[model samples]
Target: MSWVTLNDMRTWLVAGALAFALIALFAPRIDLTRDAYDVLAVIDITTSMNTRDEASGAETVSRLRAAKTALREMLAKLPCGSHLGLGFFTERRTFLLFDPIEVCENFAAIDEAIAQLDWRMAWEGDSYVSRGLYSAIEVAKSLDADLIFITDGHELPPLPFSGLPPFDGKPGDVGGLIVGIGSRTPTPLLKYDEEGREIGTYAAQEVPQENRSGAPPPDASTRPGYHPKWAPFGNAVVDNSEHMAVVREAYLKQLASVTGLSYAYFGQREDLLEPLVAAAHARPLKVASDIRALPGSLALILLVFLYGLGAVAAGRALIRSSLNLPPPKGAK
Candidate 1:
């Protein structure tokens, strides 16, 4: 889309204010909405998570393991009166690990689900970020607590999941924090064969097999360790910090878009969950006053969106000037 000039922007803003004033004069002040302490941890379980770190000799931990550790730790640290939940994506779709629970609450069911994690899902891997997110949003709506996204932060395109309600999750009453774990830079690992031998990872074309090996078996569903033919190889890896930040930013932005929640970046479990719990306790119940009104959230979102459009216009103009742009020419 083209950028709006300062003059045009000012005019648009004025027009908007006038239009809103006319509506507000006859209509009413737009009302906002929110909910109680709901938190959902959306984790990534894509196949690439099996790589070790170059910096720390964290050979015992892969990305998924690190995430699981953080998740369990966060669960144990959750304060009373707050909700804790887990959502994760593998093969491009999300599964509800531990649906939102509260401290001092019975977690047996959620714990059972957590224990059910294994090599392959009830179905094979498909890994889509958007699908995971949409599922998480649905689960979050069923909850009345602040939603927390515990993730590696990468979003894939939507992989259609069944039994999901119809809505993109905007104009909903869910809010919470996004705690990012692991680096954004990818940590691609060497593939292993079935015998856990370090066979090379899968390439576009199949490499050579053994000497007339008795008809080598079919391709694997899991990571290859010792594919009789391809030898193991490793690539120089970059730090994942940047990708981590980007994935989280994307996830949190999606969270805000779906549910108007302020995404906080806290480090440790205590650092993360405590602030959310505190915010929940102190959460202004002013939104309760708005529920009785008609289409409040929609109206307010429109107003906020209008402000965003103005800011975007100003930003584009600045960018154009930096690149040496002429005044936008048009007949007066």
Candidate 2:
């Protein structure tokens, strides 16, 4: 298991105390991003989000809650004047929930829209990821935004290869980052009959969720038998673990490779957020986390420890590269 060393914990404690103690020591400076406005952020409200991956630990929370929490945490760090809009998608078309709004814009409007999200209106698509992605961009065509797409790999829309918008300077520009939430192995999703019996599974083509939630990995026996009435199973997504896992994995890869975009996985990994947020255009990497400014003195100490870990990793990579480490015979 990954761990924070005792020294690491103590170091964090000391740093936290020291920072808090020093806040009054120095005069606070103005935050440039405070005047900034955010762009459109699209979120997935699909049902597969209910599952937790086997890869993430047994107690891992659902994707839906994580998405909400991340947004909540992000809002706290948003630039003061920054505006945020909302969009949602399913297997087919996309729904525009809110128009763009500056941070100073109506607060209740956005929250009410978000709070109004229910499973019924979320719809069922076959996974038109490209369509959903582009749709958000289409709405933001006129305005500059840091578009954020959140989903659990539920679907990939049919994107026309020739119609993709440009980033650096093309006609169509859909600027922003994509955040994918979920795991490679999702959970066993099901569409229960009124009696609550098993049905079929829902997943994108060639994408299967890996077992990561520590639940017993799904076996074929867990799947329902062939049924003519269950045709929707093929088209309608079941809330199985396997599908959601694949959805998250495929979503990241596609956003990275297909769209020339960057992304952060927001499922149960809060530490990862700070870096991505730090990478935002207006922000410097120096502000690692929005919650607080890490002391340079403390960072130097942490770097020393990280160097030791880095050295081990470098040595292993070098050995593997040089063939200095013997391989199991015929392992390749």
Candidate 3:
């Protein structure tokens, strides 16, 4: 199929520039995007998040480290007067480390709080993701704050199809994001000592034997028909042992969908920022909304293009003048 000619490019550019200018000049007053709303950042401190699959160059980092680093950067970018709080999901429940406080005034405390997030805080090996999320929303509801739940979506002894946990809230009742962390490529989950020292990856067979909570790992005798169920079992034997640990994107997305929360991967800064802001429906403190920045940015870009074109034209004119000038004093 044939495409439009180069002439269309100029036409489109000119039209866009004019549109931006008009919008900038005639558009309603736009408010600044300094969203100063209370945001509760719930972090998953489970062992699965301790996976060491995230790597940058030669340096390797745990999923929890990546999360904390990203979160710290995001926290620093949060506007003044924006309230921030911290929570941890472990032992099958969500615990608020502290209540929501303004970022500007309590930054030191918040930063320290984030740094302290560790797998050692996990009271029970069990990670009841659905329950944890439900409890988190309930907590956020009391604070009247937006919720940002960060997790790898590792549910211990994975929930059964017949018993999906109930979400006890209306759609959008608590606006925020369910940020999934870690690589999509499943990697062996690293086991860590109580002192935060890594030992080794959990073997498939070992997964069935270890449960830090001291609760018995599910087997055919305990819960029957694949308690650590990953597949359907009829007469064939299904081993619940072998499974790679990674970011459960599909599960997280589905959970968020049912809970009326947005979902994003905690990889790029934008991935976390855009959905979070949208879900919160965060408004400028000084006004109801704002879009002037959009037009203003477009206008700036147009100016840049126009400036380049002028420079090119001026260069050509100078070249022509020099070329047309009589040979310097009839030499040559």
- lDDT-superior candidate, 2 or 3: 3
**Candidate 3, residue 5: CA error in Å?**
56
Q: Which candidate, 2 or 3, would have the higher TM-score against the true structure?
A: 3
Candidate 2 ranges with C-alpha deviation above 4 Å: 1-35, 52-60, 156-172, 192-244, 271-332
Model 1: per-residue Cα lDDT over 1-332, one tens digit each = 33555456555555566565556446644445443355776666554444443123434455556556555655666544456676666654567766666644745555555545443442433344445555666676776555555555443222122212234666545655555555544443336565556575544223221222233324322324535446221122323232221334565555445555555543333245565564343333334132323444445555677778878978978987899977577723
Error of 1 at 312 (Å): 76
Measured by TM-score, how close is model 2 to the native structure? Answer: 0.52
Candidate No. with top TM-score: 3
Error of 2 at 65 (Å): 2.4
- 1 versus 3: better lDDT goes to: 3
Predicted structure with the largest lDDT when compared to the true one: 3
Expressed as tens digits, the lDDT of each residue in 15-54 for candidate 2 is: 6655654653453554332225456767776656555452
Q: For residues 87-187, could you state the per-residue lDDT of candidate 3 as single tens digits?
A: 98886678998888988889998998899898888888878888999999999999889999999998776766344577778878999999998888778
**Candidates by lDDT, descending order:** 3, 2, 1
Error of 1 at 18 (Å): 72
Model 1 alpha-carbon drift over 4 Å, by segment: 1-36, 54-60, 105-119, 155-167, 189-271, 274-332
Q: Which ten residues in a row have the lowest lDDT in candidate 2?
A: 209-218
